[model samples]
Target: MGDTFSSLLELGGPVVLILLVISIAALAVILAKVFQFASARVGRHGLVRQAVTQWRTGERNTAAQNLIKDRSLSAALVRNAMDAIQMLDQQPLSSQERDIREERLREEISARAADRLFALASWLKALDLVTQIAPLLGLFGTVLGMIDTFQTLQESGAAANPATLAGGIWVALLTTACGLAVAIPVSVAVTWFETRLEKERAALEVLLTGVFTAGSSSTVAST
Candidate 1:
């Protein structure tokens, strides 16, 4: 078994190495994207909550510029919501209609939040694409290896060269294994993130609630 494995490795060494390099590259991209998403999400969510608090308190001291520092999507959402709140504040809608107006404002803010979160979800989709691509690449490599094995068999004359055919077949199978190794882990991670997406949607709903409450309080204060 050990000798068979060693011979197989020797046959597919170059393909295995190439697969390793590609897998490492894909893993690095995924890690960097995840880190960026996490950092921005945490930072921007905190800033949004702070801005909502100040807006609720009727604090004249808070500017959107002062509240949201970066050009992140989350910051854009908060800025847009604040603008909506300002516009609503200027309206002459009656108290009975105010609740409907408040619900509209909340939905608008939630939409902004969903858009930002959707951008983050794109990274997971990219990882999923990589998973799908890896297996196809492995299959291509296997097909090429099989072609080479059959050629070697035809050239062997009357003497059946078992070792040559076995080596080629092993090389082909190894590509499949290598491809699956990269694909399985990536797909699993994508699945995990997919499940977490609903949790994130809930968080955005909560944040929007806070923003709407703040907006409604402002309306009450003016009345």
Candidate 2:
């Protein structure tokens, strides 16, 4: 292990360090996501269950308080829904006004969902940047090795055999291989993380949809 790392350091220290940093960042992201989405604990916890409970009972304030108590990515969406429902329930309204209120609530819900999406996009962009640059840096190492090999050839004249210059070419080959290895996995990880996020978002949507429809149906039946 030590010898391999030493070879990498000597051949392309900057590229190796950059890839190391990216790998750390990617690892952190994956761990965070695993914790956040695995058991529905991080984002769901007490608030989401309470939101569903409140919807069943038509108690918007209970849902709002539950939402306000927590600050996960899902909280904003629940809070938006609670506030919109409360606003519509309290307002002096003709039927036209009620329709307007419902439309406004839909818009607010979508707006809240939009808020945390930028963070996801930023994470994906960082991974993509690393994926793009790793191969190029590896290619740079290969080019530098070729330059060193040619320089040695000039100094040694016809005396140097191809076997003598193999070390430099080997470094070039290894760097390119390492770069590709780093890039391919990082790109795949980015895709996998995005898929995880998509599933979580879908869950959130389903939770909200069921609660909203149940709440509205119960309200109408009571009226």
Candidate 3:
């Protein structure tokens, strides 16, 4: 395997080398993101939903306790919003003051949700750049190889060998193949990661809304 890789690098030249480095980096980023999503339990929201249901039924302390061990982004935002609302309820404020406070709390929770999502989305742009440029880089390498091949052919004049030209052409095209190899997988990974992020974002919005709405409903029923 090492011999094959070295031979490929020799044939593909600097462009192939760059692509190899990029592929390794992209793989690292993908693995890291996978671990991050798993650790945060990105899509596993059953517990969070249960907590929200508890909150809706006026079991505020139980709702908060249910989420105490949850580490998902949605759980964090829900906890914060729940704590904020609980604090707001404890105060002796007029109806107008309560409305103003609730709006401010929502904004603060939204901002926090954005920040958490942003953190999850870190290093995504570098992968995107790789997807965009890998093919072009391979093409650039192929073009350079072709130029060199033709230059050699020109120097050979009448003695230019057809077999040599054929060999040169395939070797020149190797960079382009390598580029696509790097790019296709990276593109797919980026797409998957992006889809997950969007889902998480939507989930956070819904969960927070439920918290606030549930709190309001509970208040209305009591009054």
Candidate 4:
């Protein structure tokens, strides 16, 4: 395998080498993102929903406790909202003041959520760049190789051999193949990561909305 890879690098030249480096970097990023998503439990929303339900039913402490060990973005934001509302309840404020404070708290939590999502999205742009440029790099390599091959053939004049020309063409095409190989998988990974991010964003909005609405209803009922 090592020999085969070395031979490919020789044939593909610098373009292939650059692609190899990019593929390694892209793989590292993908692995790190996978670990991050797993540790943060990105799509695991059952616990978050249960906590929100607890909060909605006026079990503030229970809701907070349910999320004590949870590290998902949704859970964290919901917890923040719960804490803010609980603190607001303890404050001696007029109705207007309370409403203003609650609005500010909501905005703060939303901003924090946006920051978390942005963190989750970090390094994704690098992956996107790889997907976009890998193919072009490969094409660039092929074009360069083809130009060299034709120049050699022109030099050979009447002695130019068909077998040699065929060999050169294949060698010239290798870079394009390698470029597509790197790009196709990276594109798939980018799509998957983006889709998950979108889902998480939607989930965060829904969970936070649930917390605020539930608190308002409970307050209304009590008054």
Candidate 5:
């Protein structure tokens, strides 16, 4: 293991070292996000639908209690909407005013959902930066190696060793290889993460919209 790293260091120099550190950091973020998503139980389904059914049955507080005790994102959003319903139910507002309150409540619920999504996606930009710059850094290393090779040839004049020139060229190319190595996997990871986040967002939107529609139906039935 040590020999392998040492060979990389010699071939790629400082740029390789920097790229390796960035690779490690990116991996950490990826793993941490995976764990976070797992812990969040984002995959849990049906909480919102069940809560909506209960809400429509005039068990509003009970529905809210059940959802509030859950940890999933869908549950959290439904719970917020339920809380708004409970508070609004206590007031003496007219029908038009009540409609306005529900509209605002819908916006508030969506905003909270977006905030949670943003938190999940926060460190992703750093991964994107690493993905973009890794190749450029590698190219920079290539340039540095070529410069050293030419400098050696210039100093040696006509007697420049062919083997020495070849070695310099090889080392110079190593940087580009290392850079691509660092970049490709990180880029793939970033894409996968974004895909998963989008799926979650889409699911949340469907669930929240369903809850809102259910609440509206309940209000219509009561009058």
Candidate 6:
């Protein structure tokens, strides 16, 4: 293991070291995100169905209470809207005033959802940067290695060994391989995270819409 690592370090040079660090960081982010999602259990379908049903039945506060009991993004959004309605109900405001309050509450819920989702997604960009740059760095190392090999050949002329030339070419090519190694998995992780995030956003939107229109709609269907 040690020999293989030493060989990689020698072949890829500083670019390999940089990629190594980025790989570690990407791994950390992936793990953190995985844990966050796992702990939150942020599923949209079931919770939205349950909450929307209660909302349509005019059990708004009860729905909010049930959802808020669980810690998830969709629940938080529904809770925010429901809590807003409760607060407005207590104010004895006119119809226009109540509408304005509901709108403001909706905005607040959206902002909070955005903030939470952004936090969840923020580290993904770093992983993406690693995925993008690692290959470029590897290519850079390859170019440097090739340049060194040519320089060595020019200086040595007839004395240059075939084995030495072959070694240099392989070493140069190693960086590209290393870059791809680091990039591929991170890219996969980024894609998976993006898929999960999009699902969460869709769920939140559906739930929020249900909450906002619970009064007008007779049936709240789950998506």
Candidate 5 regions exceeding 4 Å error are 53-69, 216-223
Can you write out model 4's per-residue Cα lDDT over 87-120, one digit (the tens) per residue?
8988888889989999999999999999999999
* lDDT (10s digit) by residue, model 5, range 123-180: 9999999989999999999999999999999999999999999989988999999889
lDDT of 2 by residue, 77-169 (tens): 667776676666677777687767777777667666655654454467777787898888778877877888879978999798888688768
By the lDDT metric, which is better: model 3 or model 6? 3
Summarize candidate 6's per-residue lDDT along 1-223 as a digit string, tens digits. Answer: 9998997787678988988898888899999989987776766457656977788777766677788667776776777777776676667677787778778878988899898889888788888898899899889989999999989988999999989999999999888898999999999999998999998888888878877876422223331
The TM-score of predicted model 2 comes to 0.72
lDDT of 5 at 133: 97
TM-score of candidate 5 versus the correct structure, residues matched by position: 0.86
| Candidates ranked, most accurate by TM-score first | 4, 3, 6, 5, 2, 1
Give the TM-score of each candidate. 0.65, 0.72, 0.95, 0.95, 0.86, 0.89
**Local lDDT at 189 for model 5:** 85
Q: Tens digits of per-residue lDDT for model 1 on 1-223?
A: 9897566557666666666777787788678767766765533466666766676677523736555575555556667766676676678878778778777767767766777677667767678887998887777778888998898788887786888788679878888888899899988878866766666676556655665666554554684
Residue 2 displacement in candidate 4 (angstroms): 1.3
> How much lDDT does each candidate structure score?
0.70, 0.69, 0.91, 0.91, 0.84, 0.81
Better candidate by TM-score, 1 or 4: 4
Over 4 Å off in model 6, which ranges? Answer: 216-223
Candidate 4, after superposition: displacement of residue 160 in Å? 1.5
- Tell me the tens digit of each residue's lDDT in model 3 across 125-206: 9999999999999999999999999999999999999999999999999999999999999999999999999999888888
- TM-score (C-alpha, index-matched) for candidate 6: 0.89
lDDT (C-alpha) at residue 3 in model 2: 100
Model 3 bad stretches (over 4 Å):
216-223
lDDT of 2 at 95: 65
